[model samples]
Target chain A: MFGFVNANPKSLSEEEKAIYQAFYCGLCRELKKRGGQKCEILLNYDSVFLALLLSGLYEPPENSFSFKCAVHPLKNREAYENEFISYAADIDIILSYESLKDRVHDGGALAYKKLLSSLEEIYRSSAGKYEDKAKAAALCVKKTTEAEEEKVSDIDILSSFTGEMLSECFVRKKDEFSEKLFSCGFYLGKYIYLLDAYYDYLSDRKKHRFNPLHLMGFSNMSDMTDFTEPLLTAYISECVNAFEMLPVLTYSGIIRNILYSGVWSRFNIAKKRYLSKEQKK
Target chain B: MDPYKVLGVSRSDSDDDIKRAYRNLSRRYHPDANLNNPNKDAIEEKFKQINIAYDQIMNERKGGAGQSAGRGPGSSYGYRQAGFSDDSAFGGFSDAFRRNNERQQQSDGISPEMQAAVNYIRNGRSSEAMHALLEVPEYERNGTWFYLASVASQGMGNMANAQNFISRAIQLEPNNPTFREFSERLNNIGAGGWYETGRAAYGNPYGNNSSSSWCADLICMNLMCFCCRC
Candidate 1:
């Protein structure tokens, strides 16, 4: 997804692309800084944007270095100073922990056990660094999984669970934008829940497994576009608006482009393809 | 910014008209339906107008009373409005209400995870977005996350996930016009009469035609597209 945004036709210049790559590389380095080498593997564009968004608060160091990694030794990329990179790394670790945790529960037995054993070492190390957040995210996922197991059909219950996880990531600055970030996470969590169900619908159906849509009896994807699009736009608008409100400055344009044009365009293509596939059949 | 104007109601329009207008605009701009429309400049304009108009009408209706704050006794007595409360003292309350709303708006920026989720969403990374979003703390989950995640999943061809997220959003902020519209849109899926009729038409006794993936997809698509557009 970040790759798509980086290459998107946004009328951006060569310099802008380089800056974007720097931010991306900065994020990658940060993941390594905070979570160690293994954590760097979880590095992705989203966390890079997080690094960029937070970058507004602090100035980047005067000196950046172009370094090669084991995977991309030939492709020299620019990385930011330690702190910016560190922030990105921390987020990666935290995010990776939560993601692996979710997977462990979602995947059955062998897969679950394998995930747990693999994650145990990483979780132990990262949890100490991000103690409270890691713990809170774990609890939230636990509660959420329990609810799902109990056949909890309540949408609010699950959304709140996701929202809780998002709230743990931020340091809660006194600035007004802090609250907006909270709201952004809130809505995004809700949107993700439904999308997860949608993506897994056929498989769940085939497996005769549980899905909220089946629980709710939803029939098709188009019908849901109406249900999902407006709230998304509203929240995205709010997130953008809040980011604009912040007195602190950094990478606002990059974040904004990714949110409005980048995200929306991708959604359009996906929906268009889905519709086209339906048409083809 | 007339409330009546926002709701597309006449100055003297009935409450029902105001309600109907709100519903119509809500349906039209409700995020779920307008997915991937490329953020048209007019849509934002329309949204602003509707919000302002609705706010104004709601204020007037809520605050208007005998116009007793001014004017002569007879005029004040005769000025009693039908819909508004008699307690006109709180007339300036709407300003405070709007101010609070503004403050709420000031708080909603995208987090790094949200940015990633959006990226994943754009790239059709439905599950990845879901996984990325899992990092967001509980208190942080708001209507925007749910909506965007839902849209992202939909783009990834995951309607069930979209429905689940949208439903969670609606539950969190039940009265949000956007959230409510989203929920309604999800509810309408697969429940359309046309699909049922078409399914009936394309029935197979021995083969159970509806069970075939191709037939199911076609019937669902046709019925959904036709029924929803209406």
Candidate 2:
């Protein structure tokens, strides 16, 4: 759920684009309102995607209004206001706070400590509201730390930890589509976990950081790509397959574009960057 | 059942249109196609309904009583009823789809070693599966064998070996879409290239080489640039 989820703007129509923007701005505004202006920095496409998915699944009444903001002071951009947006915003704050807290503890980074302190109240409130989700997230962090400490080498096991955490987050709302949503999030989470590991393999190796691919005996990027890319693609295909089965009414096209293509674009970006870096060497 | 509605076509649609619709829908709902799908049972049921619909429509058109006689819901119908017998134009699509499910059950009617390997891969024991595959006689290694070996290699993070095996699979069955797609992806990654080279020439960073996301970046860039210009 880190800012990897994005919609392919090309596949979106003007109205769909507006809807996406409204949701994005809407999440940002919610974050600022709930977690303060500083927390707005944590606004990401992943949260917006979550909001879009939940909204599409729930088919809630549309509630949007045009508003002028600092980024676009001259234009009154549409801002969507809804329960899902606020929920996503709160989840984002909690995640950011937890992530910052982990980084602060690991590296003793004073700046992160200060930021975490600032968001402490908001995090506490969000954690109270979503106790189960907060617990699941904390468990994920704990499991990840354990895996790193033990130097677990199995990519499947390591990625499943993150996948489980995300599955909990996605199925926070128990409904008819809960199972499908869980499966979709589970696979997407796995893809993200593997993609992050694959992307960081070289740097992690150089820094002697804990990378599952290196631990799994992949010596180079090409070898890593060959072994993991197919598995990653399979996860994406499974995610898309699950996504197709969900009975999404609104923004299905846009969501499909993101699932089917937008996520793949991120892979392409990583591939290009890796290729260019290799050529430079 | 209205075969036209089942195939999502109008009654006035030409034979070619009806055939095309049936082909597309059947492929989409095929049990083998939706193997990982949780709704596979429903899809399989829909596929049977589709076959029944197509058979009934074709039979009606041919002035024959259509194989609706004594064929229960769960009964298997031969692929020959699709009017595709001896027709090379369809490239035996119906036969391929029919055999896809059957092949899963029989493991392509190969020896126990091949079936064991397939079962191991299905159960997530890729190393054991690869071992089983290795024991197969070299001459007995066919497309299915190579494809399964490729999958097992991929599971073991041996992408180079996976690519080699999948290439062999593609060579044996060049017309297999699944094998071709797998080979194409393996080659693309092995070459360290994304999508196709033609797409890179068009200044599309994500290149339109693959069917998914083709021209996606170009269209997105143009749209954003146009909006910014305004």
Candidate 3:
């Protein structure tokens, strides 16, 4: 669902890179187990992190299975069996479905449009299984699409909508720890929206498309990095704070490094790179 | 909750130790550091608790000393009380966004150019302020330029010139407390105002007795120009 991860090559240390790959593979295994091979492509780091978090939080029923992916032919793969991973898989389907629907409505190109259309049945079935998450994701995407169409200026409203949807996913099994997880999701949702809005700004401008920052009349994206950096800093801090709440599962170390060092620094450096590229152009 | 214990201090710890403890704890549980930690809810709750504990202990100690001195007594303690139910301070300050129409209304029918000048002043963009101020209509140029000049002069550390420009600001905004404060602060640093301690205006507040009337005359001359226009 988060296309930005692939587009931006945020460098990571060897250890972090290995953890990320393992998580990515782990997510692939999860999607396949939950919804079959068709859902494997729906796997991404965003959902992987969510899976890892849920695993850490709930201690999933068991950590079981091994396999190999086309991406890593010779390597052994591990799949975790748990409620959180299952939930993450469901969410991935819901988000991907809604995002696809948005793209179709927004006039996405042929292959992408077709792929999303083909996945609808599977998405609908998964949505049926996880009704609340599906509903929330659908509602958030709908609101975001509507705001884009209407050209709304309060970017936080749409960002919060996305945040609330993710937050809702965690809030269902409410407890002291989940509440912290919800808060983390809330700010991270805002961070994601800001970054996506920023990365898409120039292209959106060229295509006569809507960007949240553009709606606010911020001419330069870096100008927003100052405003956005604090949110990112807060996002990382929340992740750190959430760490204490985590029950310390199998992949806790992997998740922590990805969150604290990888995602944090990537977001921190992205604006600088984006600005310099804009300057060069 | 023992406030001293909350701050990791003994009851006999010096004021400096207490301050240091508060600073260290504040940095550790600061909302910025733990943005999305799964335990953010607990951290925030703990943070609020720590803040309250520290404040209570510090205030009790300060109050005890102040009571002994009997100086500035009976005044309301402005320090934020922890027992208060309001969490707005803990949530962080909100910058209220006034809608464009409301912003225009607040500018008193000022042209967009003049409004931009004022915004530049508030944002510390003096060059931009000058650029925008120049765009004001000729009829309104005097007031706009003077206000912009006051902000620019103040930013540039030319207090005398700043006072001159501020007097012009007073002519335009007689009842504006902010402008009055600016004028008052400038006057205090020069001839003498409330900020001057143990010296009357006539006694040469700058400590050079002969300098009094000269500085006072400069202020009087500036105010006269402003009064003449008013």
DockQ values, each candidate = 0.02, 0.05, 0.02
Per-candidate TM-score, chain A: 0.80, 0.94, 0.83
Poorest stretch of ten by lDDT in candidate 2 chain B: B66-75
> What is the CA-based DockQ of model 1?
0.02
Model 2 chain A lDDT-worst window of ten: A238-247
How would you encode candidate 1's per-residue C-alpha lDDT over A1-281 as one tens digit per residue?
12222223243356655666676666766655543544444655555655666666444563578897554566665766556556556655666667665765566546445544655676677667767667767777787788888888755456556555654454323231344344444444444455455555567879777776567655566665565454344333333423432333345555655544544444454466556676677
Worst 10 residues of 1 chain B by lDDT: B67-76
CAPRI level of candidate 1: incorrect
Error of 3 at A159 (Å): 1.0
| Quality class of the docking in candidate 2, CAPRI style | incorrect
Error of 2 at A187 (Å): 0.5
TM-score of 1: 0.52
Candidate 2: chain B TM-score against the reference chain B? 0.38
User: Using lDDT as the measure, what is the rank order of every candidate, best first?
Assistant: 2, 3, 1
| Candidate 3 local lDDT, residue B55 | 53
* Candidate 3, B4-94: lDDT as tens digits: 7777889887765765676667668867779989899888887787767765564455334221100011112232331102213111101
